[model samples]
Target: MIVGMNMENQVLIVEDEDSLSSYLKTELTFENYDVLVAGDGEEAMTEFTEHQDTLGVVLLDWMIPKLNGLEVLRRIRKQTATLPVIFMTARDYVGDKVAGLDNGADDYITKPFEIEELLARLRVIFRHEAQQLQVAPVYEIANLKLDTKSHQVTRDDSHVQLTQREYTLLLYLLQHKEETVTRDELLDNVWGVDFVGQTNIVDVYIRYLRNKVDRDHTPELIHTIRGVGYTLREEE
Candidate 1:
């Protein structure tokens, strides 16, 4: 059992299949996670709303009843854009996986997965979230400041709005300022080591951060390392 498990570390399982849902609940509970089960999209949303503050992550089945997984994720994103969501689907198609990620899933696992792997993935997500919480409330570099407690970023006197993923990515870069951080490193630290998707996700989010943090700003703090990776440092 997990030591010191609490409501704040709870996980929500949204799966319509009776056998699978029960198995997940039992396994998660065995691991000492406060588990909440919902058998359909509607129920999932209801449970999410009721326990949003307590939920640490969501394990959502792709083909759930009433609203489908993507729709449920869409609604969830509207409410809390940063809430971690993992899509569980039997479909092995890359297109489906891409759609899920594009629609807001933080990760996706093909069905018939081993429970051990799932547990490991959950641990990674939880670890990353905990690390973020422990970060200093404010980080500043060359007039750019990030406030972890407020979830806000500003340059000079201008505020910059970012999606949760973007904010996390930028924070990671700032944490490793001046050092070239590889795509694999970013994937492992920011997206989790179990993440099984395109590495281009790093590039995509880098573009996003650059647009918001540096496009119109001076002394562009984010820099490409040319064939190596990327770095965040004041221009030389």
Candidate 2:
């Protein structure tokens, strides 16, 4: 879907309204997501069954040509044990939203929703799923082992203790190893866009990462590129 992104995640949109389904498909595709459109509840179920492994989330409409939203949600919940499903309906009534969530929908987004809001919700769902999708994140370079899932790091059989901010910062740097990562990019992505602070946060975290992961090492792992940003790599 998105260039350079893993297509292991898929989203299904079930809406009988051809116009609405097409619009969603286009918008999601532009965001680099693998999206499938199902015209009705039955079709949605079929797609879900076929792509269960890769189906990360679903957007189900309230009324469809073949089966109604509630019935579809019931069938999906019975079939999909831990799959995330979001209800999309024109009915903005509080009762309808409550009913949908009570019946197992992960979230209920009313129709005429803001595109940005929908994207934000999808991001949250995907991130939550990703955390559960991986058992561990063990990244290694040379004699060092970084266990992001466990928040632990070890070098040459010796345990390296790091603060929460340091661990998170190192993991982020390691994930994008060898790339020049900007301070603003780090602030926005790591702490979230709404982080009520300045880019100095990145500097503070970088210092922490340096102390824990690089101080005793021979060749520096984290390199500061003047006028640009930082890079984490094995290269000198």
Candidate 3:
């Protein structure tokens, strides 16, 4: 029975492989994260439920005894939809990835991956989740309004649905309104330092925000600064 000492910053690692699990536990502990290990799905479920409130993230392995990772994740989502779960699996097929994602896995990482990358991903997840807890002052630009405490956004009195990442990105833009936020800055602030130049993820998320926040509204709030980055401001 693996028990977690520090509830704060706890991470549940659900991997059946003893060697890998031990290694992860050691590494994560060294990084100051409270680590809990469960060799099988049943143990994973029990530990997760017991420490759900304190758990920052779950590093879940796809293949496990009693219940697979996806099933465990499904159960976890049924309880808390926003809890971050990253699947660590050897499966690299597109179908497998889609299945994990559709079932509420927040991130997917293939096996034999770099420990540094895994740690980085966990940092990003924790950083994003931490932002959600902050008490941000209500922001307004023209007809758009965002209440960080309520975690809601409205444009012209219509509520807009935004993913956690989108909400964070928007909040950052509103905080720095009228300023061109460079891609690097966004990546650092929103996605964390680990995602500095890994593909055009920043651009992709910008499009996502625009589609929901500005696609139907007049006077776009998110503007592309061509060759520089993006800025959120009322039309001139």
Candidate 4:
């Protein structure tokens, strides 16, 4: 078992190969990991939704029955932004790698990788998560409250439904409360360092966030600076 990460948190292995799945499960279990196995893409989603709160990492196979790994990953990102996922794919094509990472995979390993390498990767992921795992009290600006632990946002006690990307963008803004966050900073933090998309992607997401966070709300919190970037501050 890993020492830093909570042992109660499980690693979900989504693999249809019985032999490899069994091998991985045995190895992880021997190391004190709580393991959940899924034979196909659909089952992976079911297990994910059922145990999302307790899941620590997901070892997602690229090719699976019912749905491909990329599709499964897209669905997972739709629900939560913080969950760490590592793709296990036999294919080493550049496009495939880009698709997986672009879809929010924390890391990926080509198939036939050594067990020690996989464990090292897991440790790195756990270390990163440990930095942000501590639950904090809700951040409130005006009537909006965002609970980082529960990943919930509310306005005047009314819950707001935010997509995974939207939630991450909002959370970053709240964490930097009352500060002007530049597009470069937002791209670096929210979109990951390897983001190769158009620079306007930041502007696009800010627009998306404003529609949900400020629209119809009094004391609008998201504001644009003509030449700078954006800030989340309550205004009269």
Per lDDT, the best of the predicted structures is 1
Q: Candidates' TM-scores?
A: 0.86, 0.54, 0.70, 0.61
Measured with C-alpha atoms, the lDDT of residue 172 in candidate 3 is 93
Q: How many backbone clashes does candidate 3 have?
A: 0
**Tens digit per residue, CA lDDT, model 3, 1-236:** 21211225789999999999999999999999999999999999999889887887899999999999999988887666446678999998878976886666656789888999999988888766665565558999988998876667899999876644567788899999999989989888876776523536678778877888898898888999989999998873
Tens digits of per-residue lDDT, candidate 1, 1-236, equal: 11111226799999999999999999999999999999999999999889887788899999989999999998988776567789999999988987887776777889999999899889987886677677556888998998776666889878776655676788899889989999999988887777767888899789878988999889989999888789999984
Q: After best superposition, candidate 3 residue 146: deviation in angstroms?
A: 3.4
Q: Model 2, range 150-208, lDDT digits (tens) per residue? A: 44578776877553335556767887888999988776655546444356657766776
**Model 4 clash tally, residue pairs:** 2
Q: Which regions of candidate 4 fall more than 4 Å away from where they truly are?
A: 1-9, 15-37, 59-63, 69-129, 191-201
- What ranges in model 1 sit over 4 Å off? 1-7, 155-164, 215-219
> What local distance difference test score does each model get?
0.83, 0.72, 0.81, 0.78
Quote the lDDT for 202 in model 3: 77
lDDT of 3 at 60: 97
Candidate 4, 78-179: lDDT as tens digits: 777657788999988878876886676756788888898888767655543554466656788989998865667888788776654566678788889888
Itemize residue pairs with steric clashes in candidate 4: 1-31, 1-32
